[model samples]
Target: MTEDFQEIVETFEFLDDWEDRYRHVIDMGKTMPPLDETLRVPATKVDGCASQVWIVPHIEGNGPEAVFTFQGESDAMIVRGLIAILSALFNNVTVQQVVDTDAAAAFAQLGLDQHLSAQRSNGLRAMIVRIQSLAQNKLASDS
Candidate 1:
């Protein structure tokens, strides 16, 4: 949801420093519901991440209006926060919306790109690509 991203931006704007923001992000990760153990398979695992990450996707509805929802986990706390942020930003939205959404822009708005290491940033991009791939696959199936 765009509003959700906006809210996140506004919330982070109030924090005084990057350290505070990082803590807020880790707290956000804590709020995410734990991923089920069954979904933590190799196929669901996101490669290119320095940390172990697994993502599970479910598509709801049909045709252009289908919504792509995701659940994910990571072995690292920071990566878990990244996964939580991605899930919140992309989940329960239309397939076209998911494809069109600019996650980089949101990450930029949050100043995440500046704060992250190169490897972590690459992992984040990998996660976004995975989400987009899921949406594209659903669109093809609906067609």
Candidate 2:
């Protein structure tokens, strides 16, 4: 796991209850800067989510070795927090690392895997897919 995400895990361990964890997640979202409105176009928009969602990829250097990150947003506060969590999981990693990470297992460590509603879970999976697809595309292009 990325150090950023490990911090979240450690925080979750400190929190006493699910409510507190949820609050922490929401708080994380609250701090995320809103994505620029102009970038919320169709191309960046993620489908299959019940709430509106967008992720704009930011890559540094070039090719498969590039460091990958993104700025993301969602209409729902909880979803936005989820995006922040994903950022912790993915940000600053190589495009190859982003593609290789087991996001499901990482989220499982947070205990969100069991707590999220089916719809939210689906939405999360959709977001992961979008992220992985972007990394895969980058890798392919570089090759």
- Give the alpha-carbon lDDT of every model: 0.88, 0.95
Expressed as tens digits, the lDDT of each residue in 1-143 for candidate 1 is 56766778898899979999999889888888888898889999998888999989988898879978889999888889888889778988898899988889889989999999999999999999998988988898889
lDDT comparing candidate 2 with the true structure: 0.95
Query: Each model's number of backbone clashes?
Result: 0, 0
For residue 52, model 1's alpha carbon misses the true position, in angstroms, by 0.6
- State model 1's lDDT: 0.88
Tens-digit per-residue lDDT, 1-143, candidate 2:
78999999999989979999999999999999999999999999999999999999998877878999999999999999999999999999999999999999999989999989999999999999999999999999888
Instruction: Note the residue pairs that clash in candidate 2.
Output: none
Runs with alpha carbons beyond 4 Å of true place in candidate 1: none
Model 2, residue 128: C-alpha shift (Å): 0.5
- What's the TM-score of each model vs. the native? 0.95, 0.98
Off by over 4 Å in 2: none
